[model samples]
Target chain A: MGREDKAMVKKAEAATGADNRPFLFRRHDAGTIREAYRKMLLIRAFEEGAENAYMRGLVHGTMHLSIGQEASAVGVGLALRDDDQITSTHRGHGHSIAKGAEVKRMFAEFFGKETGYCRGRGGSMHIADVSKGNLGANGIVGGGIPIAVGAALSARRLGNGKVVVCFFGDGANNEGAFHEALNMAAIWKLPVVFVCENNGYGMSTSQARATASATIAERAGAYAMPGRTIDGNDLSAVAEATEDAVSRARNGEGPSLIELKTYRWRGHSKSDRNRYRTKEEIDHWMTENDPVKRIEADLVAFGILDEAGLDAVRASVAEEIEAGIAFAKESPSPDPADLERFVYTEGA
Target chain B: MDQPVRELSYAEAIREAMAIALERDERVVVMGEDIGVYGGAFQVTGDLIERFGPDRIIDTPISELGGAGIAVGAAVTGLRPIFEFQFSDFATLAMEQIVNQAAKMRFMLGGSVSVPVVMRFPAGSGTGAAAQHSQSLEAWFGHVPGLKVVQPTTPEDAKGLLLAALEDPDPVMIFEHKLLYKTRGPVPEGAYTTPIGKAEIRRKGRDVTVVATGVMVSRALEAANELAAEGIEVEVIDLRTVRPIDTPAIVESVIRTHRLCIVHEAVKTLGIGAEISARIAESEAFDYLDAPIVRLGGAETPIPYNPDLEKAAVPQVPGIVAALRDLATGRR
Candidate 1:
């Protein structure tokens, strides 16, 4: 191997640390890796912007920010086809943006503007874009699991070779809908991948206290499906694992459960007081296991691009997000005359 | 000229509706527990698996939450899924998906997607299924904004309404009375849709107007016959859909008869009768009523296992006859 390639391997090892999880390039090429990095950066910048908006009272309601779980969010996008379907959780801005939702419309939703995906009726929690294959981002925890199963069933019934990725949090594992959905998906051999973003804490309760199993993926055996847990902060690790699951689903091997072991850099929402975990613990994860920084380090170590290229990606993402916010600000609010228009398919 | 219609049981009519839907649209599928090989708890989906195979006639696990959620998901994603609850009472288990997710998705999502799902519940008290399996929960579903609540009282309506509900672009709750499943009626062959929000007048009398739903419509017809012999003519109107109720029909009937009696198998308090009564009282029907509006509904208690007690709990032929007789005679 060349000196730069050897140096990249060493840097990947250093970044991965003692865990030594293999960084196999399954579906990600250099172009896709660069695109994945750009998407992850966009998600991070978008979340930071959402938080700033929430703080400034520009965002009307609270939102769950996947600030540190960018790799897990963007990795699935990079691994799957553009038309692959997904159902997201309340903490779904990162997933939505990574899955190719228009950032301006998402910002408009937060601003309660008429140009939003739901035309401002569904605020932060219920945003969705059906055309992009995002069934919706659910407000209810584990709500999208069954919906993803149904979407998979639809894809199969329609004879369209589409796979569904169901994104959920650690807390949703205990919900009845989760177990039911998994069992149904398993039995039907539905083309769905259950991607659990186990970010250590489900709101206030730590996973250690809330769950009996050491890892969420261990429960997959009960349903007779293949499952694994990997470092969600490592973009390559997430991509490798998700690529396998997506392939299995597309090949009609039924569903697979993948638990991305990651942490949330921000509080669950704006109201969270950070009383659940200590500042030291939060600081440790933020500095040591930041997903965005981990990928940046990998790109730098490979000598693929220097500081100038990385800075250019960051600057462009920031500019795009800022422009989205401006567009949202300029969008008009919904008219009062159309207040009761969308309650049903036809008027009730 | 009258069209020729075939006589079929209410259950057969429902099966025929599903079979026709499956044949016409490849997007349509039937899903529920024990609905495939077991042929459903009431045999409503018999021989369907043999014809359509297991893919189209899906038998779900005994998980209402999971099955209903899957149906909701499938519906929004462009599949016309007909989900049956073996018993209407089991709907309590699937309320989260039905009420929160399926019903609210369109409104909450600002009309971006439509959940064209049809959930069938074999409702009302008749069999020895007793309390757990014999509750009339149509009022509960009707109270929700996004749901279209309908109860088919005849075989013709059972077929026509089911087919029409499948055509709607929203979630529809179809409550088929368990007792009426065996009752044979003239059902039109081929594709047809019964208008959802219209009422049918089975018998037109000049003395008292009787508005009934589900099996009560049959009971009211029997009561009208008994009252006709006693010189008290009773008009019987079958209210097909409860949510988008035929209020104009009720008002018109009350104006002609000058008396009103609302009958249902659901509990008297806050039941569907209350809504109809309130609508009439708020409209022009109140000025035309010669007597007070009478609500002859089920007693406020759990449905008993004993046949006699179960029969007494709801408004029967005897109860409907008595209520209409009293209203016509001014004996209130």
Candidate 2:
């Protein structure tokens, strides 16, 4: 369907059908689901802590929190192997978390400590851990699209059985780079999945006003590629859709654009004053489709661990975050002489 | 030994060089906005796609920022990308990729990778394309670290400079003037890489040392002949590579002639001439200066559309002659 028909179809399904449920697995493990739930909680706790620190004038520079969009990050990140690469957006704490960044180092980075990933040089928008295949969290809108295309091109040319998952917002789809990168990836059959985390806004402007289409994924048809949108709040649905895209890319089927219908919990940045969005809208999602709460209730209903286990996970994650803050606080700043150090190769 | 063909223009020399490079190196790809099927803005890369196919000769979207960033990413992944900016003026759009990213990658990665990328721009003002299209921004890049900057005046230098840039394990910016493309000169056939960070003495004389760059090299030669009629000998040096400058060439010529005049197409204030003047002033050649070192560059104003006004904006044949005359007579 065209993008215009997508939301209408979704609304009609919401009114008529029973809530979509997956078939119960005969051999699904409770530990695995619990671990995923724990990760989502940690991401929430970590991002909320960062937002509080930013307000108290402790964290330097700006931050983009992914509090409300935990399931999309955990779902897709869980589906990929260690060697597969992924490019993230500015609101990318959850993406980094899924790629397995230490909570302490992330806190250290936000604190501008030398022990951070970028040596504290790159702030929130530029965090990177290439060892984990997180290329980076890009600052410019639609910036990561082209870089991910290059990575996919390299992987395809080298015959490396790796696929790249490129995460961009709805606003990025409006950029020319998105279309250019998607078209190139399509024609070349590059091993890439264009993951559009279509959270409502692309910064101040609403997605409806900025984009002509109803959804970013439907626009992928013009490139003659498969496009699908999943309930980004549903971990199982997101994981299945993403796994399909990654597997297709690895099997030499070119690229696929998947739109994860998610939302950001906090303001666009640290200093958001809630001028554009309302508390009522925030309350609606917080009460109904909160990813962490839904997954927690689902696990509980399935006879997984009880409230005691969840509380223990929270305590341990909090202590780890505190240690990371301490580590960053105790870490030394880079010397002034080091500023002129890395500008060029000293010699051949 | 016989030369391969007749005289070729500087622009044609560049095209031949790119064709040879693309033919020889599979990793070499040419990318720009209108370069692929459109034949480029100046036709320097005319019909390359027909020869090399679209994979190697790519016509990128009009997003210079995105194109440049993609080139940087491709370079890091072991591709030799030859990026073309339609005009030097449009380079402002891609400066972030060139200045911050391309120039900083090697160092940041702890020398793990090399940015073997070449960027070509149609620099200088001769084709009355007005302010937005015509500009000379090479000096801005030459001042930056980790970049090898070049400005070739003749066809021979064009071929040699591009070949040299392709071989170097660094990012190189080549400023080819719009006027010098049709200006033909002898160019050897096949592939040859000139040594970068070096200068060539284009003309020889004694009384005054005239250090010129880009288009100014030919103008300086014309001025030397005019000065020769007045019994004033002048030596001309073409600074092929502007950065990591060949200070020894300028200092040696200055020591012999005892007078130095630095000329360029950029504005006089804080231009490459100013840097050359500083180097000469600080070097041992300071004592040998019989007259104060002179700098002749673009005027401190926008490039005018009027042909005469445009000529007055930068160093002309007469400006070099007058500067040489004053220097030879030991006058400021």
Candidate 3:
């Protein structure tokens, strides 16, 4: 590891304290931390399995994998209740898993099977489990922002006390929908948290090249909302920031923006060639700043789990991914005769 | 004994329908720009804010795209939002939400959710609002699948259709003509639903079938009255719904009259008239045609600002009379 990388890791370790108990332990139990670790592993394993399936010609079309940004999804998800809703983006596999979507059904969706979340109608870009409070992932940039605000509006008017989290990439910050949605949520004091997962680059273009503001979180000031930027690789930092934001929203204090600074180890999509970034930069993040590795180290250092316990977690995740793929493979495709079944509400 | 007759302007009927929906369903909300104390651009939502209060009758900022999307999101999450576009032409700004999100939400989510949202568009020309404000874009929404598009000609249907749209589980787009807001007609009190996708035969005859929508329905009726004195009988059918069009009614009318003339305020090139004509040509009504189907619609240009030019642009009573006369007399 480079000198700068070693120093950064040391600083992160110092934040956990001299005894090595994770700072997150103050707020979360060992069981909760372990579950978070398991979810992070599941997200990584799910993406890898999906990537392998794509390579083997088992999956059609392209997918935007959140291979390195698992912590942001899990952290925010950890702060939300099962009934609290979220609107995800194109690169939303991690968010879906974090929000309690079944890996089997997600795989079934990827395989275009009828057992999929969207019953094969919506593939990678549109997976949703509304019963679980996931509105659905959107293909359009900043598309889900306004939808999330609307969900908050529903929560307020219906007196449901349910908060909504809107997840988007740094690219979406430039979209007018984002600005407008934030403003409306603030004016109405709707319960919603705007989570911007700034993973350095939007496709090939860097955030510095695309955005006018210094930071995506800073843009939240224009909407008169609280904003924060944190180390997304650090699970404790991400969870804490999201918890604060989610609490603010639940208290009817309006929306808050939490920008998670992270990076993606893989190309933007399956089609990207990684021409815009350097091999050294990608290698740096992969080896030194991997979210899964960071959490596993913390789990070990904090005595939350031993090496054997970590191995068991990994083994279970692998089995789950294998079974998910198998289930999707065995599932049936939708019938051609019922092509127009879901176009409109039947009998309406 | 007959029910007590009550007359109401098109605007009052729409307001009453919204009031009924608000009273019947706690989830119903009416939102738009200047819809509160400002009373909307055309006064269609007049005094609704006082009746329903600001929470239910919201005055959204001039953010058509965001407002429309918020309504869609609200609808998906259990609130029935009735969004009003200040002008029909402004829908272009919010097409992404209406077409991509609202229309496709249920289908994309595999029927797990339904967007029970209604969008009201104050449309048509003749108000001197110029090209931008005056447009009959019902055909635009009609072309989209998963959307229910309706046009109400009279005060009664305006109230009935709005109420029916609220009950529908899918998204419905209602296009209200700007000029017809002041036009009064008998409307019943209380809640009642006019069935969507059904055509009302406004006037019946056996010569030529004049199928019209929106303001064109009134002009067609006027033409039918004028042509009756000249021994030319014209049957006028008001096409209330544009998307799941009342095909059976049009086919039956055409089979009886043996002649068809479709009229609309939208451009004739690819308007609702084209769709109706195509449906008749493809259906069993084709064989019953005694003459070639005629379509009298707006000219191929934006609505002009001048009163004379604007009147000439769309199908007026004179234009309808001329087209109906030509078709019924075997001249065309």
lDDT of 2 by residue, A1-348 (tens): 223353454466579884333321112367766677778988998897887788788877888899889999988886788888888888888888888888777777787766777676666776777778887777778777877887776676556788889999988999877887788778778899999988898777888899998888898899889999888998877888888899999999989999999888777886778688888888888878898887766555444667787788778878877776778778877666677554554552
True contacts kept of each: 0.77, 0.25, 0.75
Runs of candidate 3 exceeding 4 Å displacement: A1-23, B1-3
Among residues 3 or more apart in sequence or in different chains, the pairs in candidate 1 whose N, CA or C atoms overlap within 3 Å are none
DockQ order, best first, reads 3, 1, 2
User: Model 1, residue B180: what's the lDDT?
Assistant: 91
lDDT of each: 0.90, 0.81, 0.93
lDDT of 1 by residue, A33-77 (tens): 777888888988888898898888887778888888999988888
Instruction: Give the residue spans of candidate 1 off by over 4 A.
Output: A1-27, A346-348, B1-3
Which 10-residue span in candidate 1 chain A carries the lowest summed lDDT?
A18-27
Clash pairs, candidate 3, are: none
Residue B19 of model 2: what lDDT? 95
Instruction: Specify the poorest-scoring 10-residue window by lDDT in model 2 chain A.
Output: A19-28
**Candidate 2: how many backbone clashes?**
1
Which lDDT value does model 2 have at B307?
80
